[model samples]
Target: MQDLTKEPRLSKKQYLVVASMLFGLFFGAGNLIFPLHLGQIAGHNWLPAALGFLVTAVVLPLLSVLAISAVHAEGVYDVGRPLGRWFALLFMVLIHFTIGPLFGTPRTATVSFTTGVAPLLPKSWETGGLLLFSALFFLAAFLLSYKERKITSAVGKVLNPVFLVLLFFLFFVAYSHALGNPNAQAATTAYRNGGMSFFNGFLQGYNTMDALAGLAFGVTVVTAVRGLGLKREGSVAKVTAKAGVMATGAIGVVYLFLIVLGSMSVSHFKPSAEGGTAFNQVVTYYFGTAGHALLATLLTVTCLTTAVGLVAAFAQDFHKHFPVLSYVQWLALMAFASFLTANFGLETIIAWSTPMLMFLYPFCMVLILLSVTAHWFGRDPVVYTLTVGFTTIPAVLDMVASFPAVVSQSSVGVALTHFRDSFLPFASLGMGWVVPAVVGLVLGLGFHFASQRRQAGAATSNDVQPDNAD
Candidate 1:
């Protein structure tokens, strides 16, 4: 392999352009619209929700980029080394499936359907229109993916900027003119849980799946900057970090602006709409039908790009691991799977994704911590296993509790309610998992180093005794 750390460097202009590309790659309008809906529903609790949303949506994604940069890691699984290859591959496959067809592709269809198809259709034509529109949607995605280089870049540069500029315009108008009262309380059962409400929003943000995607994208950013003459791994890391920081800052600004817009709009707008619906109303209120149309187009394009990039990556990764499968074959399989999954619609996708995110986010966070902490414990597997084991227990219970089917049980479902009831720590909204995991990591490291010292001492003592006998 090439010595990536020894390559050339990028200029300031190239760095910023790299950052812009990074921002565009991650910042789909679909991501933006969801927050507006979350905010409108959250109302006065928007702060907590927004804070939570930023963790998964912004912060973790940023860290994911850092994870790749820290080791010049090629992908998420590369960084998953401390966990073992098989474990990493299992995770990589799960992450790819979740972000690919299982949740992602269908989301593209649904978001595109609601934004593009639903607005023009009546109640009578809804179901058939959805089926027709999504079929055509993925079909287009399939065809365009065949000529990927041209379509991906064209959409990225042309359609993306237009969408972003229009979005800023809408946010500016909404924020400046204001809506109704800015101080309505959260009425939903989800928000009634107190401080944990914010965390719930945070975890919900993970469903966007951007953080995991960002890890994969770090390679793209590095490669792009490298093309511009930045070759050294350190330089690439520096540029990538700067670009990630810029992208995160931009996302943060937009999320904050939109949440405030959603919050202030409460007096004038009812929280009847879910996710993008409330957002579309706010857009239509300001930009009218034409504005809504433009937003729809942008979302479709944003989703298209995300869908294509995800498909391309999945195919490439699949081929890399199992060389017998060709890229085209994998792409076909993925698009087909995505088409079926997409039919499930956005509401269902979002509902099912929550539990999965709750389980994975902590694991993702732990991986990030371990990658950075590798040298501290001498990169010992025992330490890794101990910390991960501690983390998984609470996360597993949280996953079951939050599962869409069980979330409504009130007892965290029937028999499980007894489990949580007996386990007091699990009762406090699953935040109980965070502290113990951290403690386990700390204690595990201590034990790892202590054992290592004993082993080294015994080896030295044994060697010295041989000389004494001689």
Candidate 2:
């Protein structure tokens, strides 16, 4: 290995480039769509809603990156290891699947298709269009990710800047020519009450999935930092924190702008089915039919960079664990699986993803918070086990309640939903796990102190016995 002592810290230029790469990895499909959708829903209440969205989408994700750096974890497996080997393995698999072929990776393609290409085609052509688009998308991603070490250069130096330019240009035009009066737009029923609106926006942030992405992308980022000649763990962690802050700070600003743009669009156009369509409509309004090409280019470039990062991260982690497959083989498999899932269409993918997110986000949030504070608690396994255990029941209930109406309306679902709402605090707001998790943390801390005291007493007794014998 090269001498890391030569450069313990990244220079300012290197930091910016790395930060841009991190931003590229996080700013994909959900990042674009969710804020816009939240804006429309929140309307006159957008400020509180946007603030709430930033809590989960930006702040939590930033903390997650720092948590990985804090614990010096190579990936999610290490993050979950304190719970047990088996639990760590299971957590890793669930996270990769959620952020990989099952949901997130495919989402980039589907979102791109929905926002960029779908409008250009007839309604009947959507299925075939998505298939073709996603296939090509994953293929390009695979090719780029093949040279894993080049991911930062590809995304940061090339793709991310282009996406930003296009995105900012759209923002400039939208603001220059006011679309409508956001204050005049009535808030949606879900957002009519300010408190509920904030909570709803908080819950909606779960849809971005960046908090999960932060954990999943940890390995990729750590490796990049190491490549930059940072051998010391503390140096790596510090650099990671700085880069994460820079990257997420940019994402936060974009979210605010998108939410405002979405609210403004309400004057000129009714809210579309989703943020993708709303975004598309805004571009069309500004640039006319030709805007279709601009929107397509913007989304494709943005999504492709994320696809490359996700595929690279998944391949690296799986190969490290399984060893049965080469990194390239894992990359190929991930790209193909994501391509198949993308053909399910954006709406179907999103519908199915909501429940999975509800189940996963609670566990993820608990794990991340515990890891960040582990230093204070001595990194006790008991704390992790208790916190995660307490969070699990409500998380499962939330998942069941969030299933598509067809499944959630069943008798069993109805009973479970009733029980959850009756027993769990904030269940109606989609944050049923918060109270239980805090309770677990308190109980775990009490046990930790009790155990510590017992150990101290035993040591004192032993020391006195030796003195008496002497």
Q: List the candidate 1 regions with Cα displacement exceeding 4 Å.
A: 1-8, 139-156, 181-197, 218-232, 406-413, 424-427, 455-470
lDDT of 2 by residue, 423-442 (tens): 99989889899999999999
- Which pairs clash inside model 2? none
What's the CA RMSD for each of the models? 3.5, 1.5
Q: How high is the CA lDDT of each candidate model?
A: 0.72, 0.90
Which candidate achieves the best lDDT against the true structure?
A: 2
- TM-score of every candidate relative to the true structure: 0.87, 0.97
